[model samples]
Target: MAMGIHKFSKRRGRGARAPMAEINVTPLVDVMLVLLVIFMVTAPLMKAGIPITLPDSRAKPLDQTPKQVTITMNAEGRVFLDDDELSPGELAERVGSLPRGADGAMPLVTLRADKALEYGRVVGVMGELNRAGITAISLVTVAGGAPAETAKKP
Candidate 1:
């Protein structure tokens, strides 16, 4: 009888251990890492710029600067500032209204125009920007024409 009671008490004691209160963070961390990777893969695709066929140029790309404004013109000769459509007058007004930097310098501007646009039309836009006191301008173009060395290689 004594032995039976002792065995029963031991079994009860074995089952009495407090249920594990600690959480396993390993699985949680793995799920978080997977979500982070998924976001990283899709984030860049979300920043799609306005569509336009830029002219070709061999000039090297400019170093992107901070506080820069992008101006885009589609094949229809419509002007867009940072993806928002604006009239010629509105463009000038909005650009001229931008706050100057600490050094009193206007923000750098990048212009991307469709190759199908007329020369005078593009120049007219440039003139508008120049009149707005935005001289620090960069033209966006795609790479065209193989380099002399690469052409000779064939």
Candidate 2:
């Protein structure tokens, strides 16, 4: 009877395997970390603007506007509205079509012009904005005291 009982216990131990109830969270954690890294790298690039060498300014930064429209002009005299290249006329039309804020105020137009661009070109872009009834225009520039070597001279 002892020999038979020993054999039965051995068989039960060998054949009966219990399923794991704990979930493997390592892979899930790994995937989530990868996604976080991707988003962290891309968030700054997602801002609506074109690449340009902004001039330096000693003036204080303006208060954050509730609504904004970004317009960029590169050194080659090409105009861009939120990354979409457009002619002066198209720029006016696009600005005109923008929805107003709750206070019935037009969106503030922020102009970013390359340092190398001719002054006349920047004024011309501003003129276009004015013609479109966009009076609240702001010029973007690097704050003063920044390293001069980092600035790209136009």
Q: List the residue pairs that clash in candidate 2.
A: 116-154
Enumerate clash totals for all models, in the order shown: 0, 1
The whole-model lDDT of each prediction reads 0.84, 0.83
lDDT (tens digit, per residue) of candidate 1 on 1-154: 6555555455554684447788899999999999999999999667447788777778887776788899899999999999799975788888999988999999889989998999999889998999898886788887664444444554
- Model 2, 1-154: lDDT tens digits are 6555555455555565556799999999999999999999999678645677789887788777668778999889899887789965798888888999888889888898999998998998899899889987889887774645666789
The numbered model that scores best in lDDT is 1
* Model 1 clashing residue pairs (backbone): none
Give per-model TM-scores: 0.69, 0.70
- For candidate 2, what is the TM-score? 0.70
